[model samples]
Target: MNNIKIKKNFSPKTYLHKYVYDDIRPIIKKKRKKVKSCDFKIVEPENYKNIVCINYNVNQLKQMCKRYKLKVSGNKSELMYRIYNFLKYSYYCIKIQKNYRGYLYRQYEKFKGPGYKNTKLCCNKTDFLLFEEIKNLPKKQLFTYKDKDGFIYGFDICSLWNLIYLNKETKNPYNRNQFPEDMLYKIKRIVHIGNIYNYDINIEVDKSDLDILSNKKKIELKTLEIFQKIDKFGHITNISWFLNLSKIKLFSFLRELIDIWNYRAQITMETKKNIFPPSGSPFNNINFMILRHKKIEYIQEKMLRLINRLITYGKNEEYCKLGALYILGALTMVNNNAANALPWLYDSFMIVS
Candidate 1:
């Protein structure tokens, strides 16, 4: 038997050059640069094909094929190709269909009678009456009424108020009238009577009493009145009246309002899903067992504005700074932008530190 001998000589540099530099180096340096750049431009169809082919497992590709009713009996590459073609063809078909429908609609509109062309034809007259009634009603009565039907009426008061407010704010009458009455009425109401403090109006706050009331107490009083008026009526036609109040008073009122809002939110989250709290729940007064997103958003906006104002013009620099940080931390629970909030946070921190 002839013995065969193989020479073994291993060099770290040679090994590294071949395996690390040649094979693995490019991958190490390779990165998804677009992600770091935060490039969110619409993805190209070709790029989608590559993503599906490279990242998807065989079963996922097969599942997608089944979902789109395409043939599933192919290797990964073939499956990917089929999926790409199907998506492309489906997209084009949808585009063409939409374009054709739009064209036909335009032609119909161009040839139709004046009455048919009027978008107001689709507007619900009853909803319009409700909107007008809501707008015309006393602000004090908008939110406070009990509906005979047990179903809370005028819940869309907030939306209607917003539309009206927006129209007036922008000086655009056309936009105000453009909405269908039903659509306008469907907008969520913002003010909740249950959240407002109850104060005896007959027991007036004299100047001396006002001087003695703590900031929190003053806020409770003002917010109580504001919410009462909102509940009684569907809208606040002249917020300028409230704005005329001292800035400190307004700021204190907003701070208290935010605290009340947070408490309500906690109660809302703790309540059983779809199961209304006992008739005794504080929410029952608002006729809402669950707090709506629109209302929450409105409160959040107010809190953000109040916090900003406190940071800008508050007397107690330390408190304002700490409050800004506190508000930023609290709002993160509600999924607000912490990065954008950092400026106020830093400003407050610098002022105090």
Candidate 2:
């Protein structure tokens, strides 16, 4: 009877498990520390050198082209040439697609995905009294684009904000005749987060509920009051009254802001280990091919910071100097000037090694 009692006491419910001591480990989440720019040093070029065509085999080149959905049939040089441009394009077009922290996998996600801030569209609901959500919309939301002429059509088409319009069947929900001449806008609404996906827009007659022209700007302030919430980054996509060209033009302008924001390498992104955080600017990256023959400084006013290391030699400047020269050589190779660029790259490798 004592043995039975001892066994019952030793059961899982009563006994301690090994997991209590063995499995539980405190997760040490290392916070990112900001590295100062003065600490930047020349490092190995191996990380970026892999991009050069000379590093890859013919089969690898063909595989890369295939992955990018490009035409894979070509000579080794041709394959390398095509892959080079595509890689450059992919790098420069940062916002187009990616799964990394600052990227979108699908091109369409630029509109649907979150992290986009637009004052007029998302935060300012009072700007338009029209029903936004499908639950509020009388009909289902369709993906479509409309023109200034007030036509409802889409290309293979369709996210229309179903604004109630006065037609033969339906009466004006907010009588248009009573609306001031300056208040009524036959504007086209592009239902997007930041960028235009599907190359389509939803055009309809948008009505303004302003009692007078002077109170037009009050809608934004009133929107915050009504919701009891303020937009996080309304200024990110807000346009001044001077930029009020046309609705379509305004949409184009908004999309431009998205590109500018994404391509800009963020300052805070750099941890203590890195000072020059942004790899390179979009301007320099895209123009490197054409600037192969030109001097680095002649390429752009905002040239690579590493380029200065070539002139300002320091004790730890080997990494910076190597990177600058390696980039110049890489850019030269992309322009089909391998004969001239090869020597510099080889010398860079020898020096760095």
- Number of the top candidate by TM-score? 2
- Which consecutive 10 residues in model 1 have the weakest lDDT in total? 194-203
Across 1-353, the per-residue lDDT of candidate 1 in tens digits comes to 97744335758645533443322222222232222224333223434434342445567667777777768998976676666655655566788987876665454333222223232332221122123343343332233121232222231233335435443332112112133333322222212221232311121224464344334333333443333333232222222223333444334344433553345224243332212222212222231223233343333345334444433332344434433334343333232243244444324322232
Score every model by TM-score.
0.21, 0.23
RMSD of each: 29.3, 38.1
Sum up the clashes in candidate 2. Answer: 14
For 1-353, candidate 2 gives per-residue lDDT tens digits of: 44422444465423433212111112212342332445432222222223341345566656666677768898865665555545554554553443442342143333221212222222222223332432233211222222233332221112113323232212111111222121112112223422233543434433443233223333332322221211121111121221222333323322332233233212232220132224422223443345456542333222322233221332334433433333333333223333243454434323232
Query: Over all chains combined, what TM-score does candidate 1 have?
Result: 0.21
Q: Which stretches of candidate 2 lie over 4 Å from their true place?
A: 1-49, 94-187, 191-353
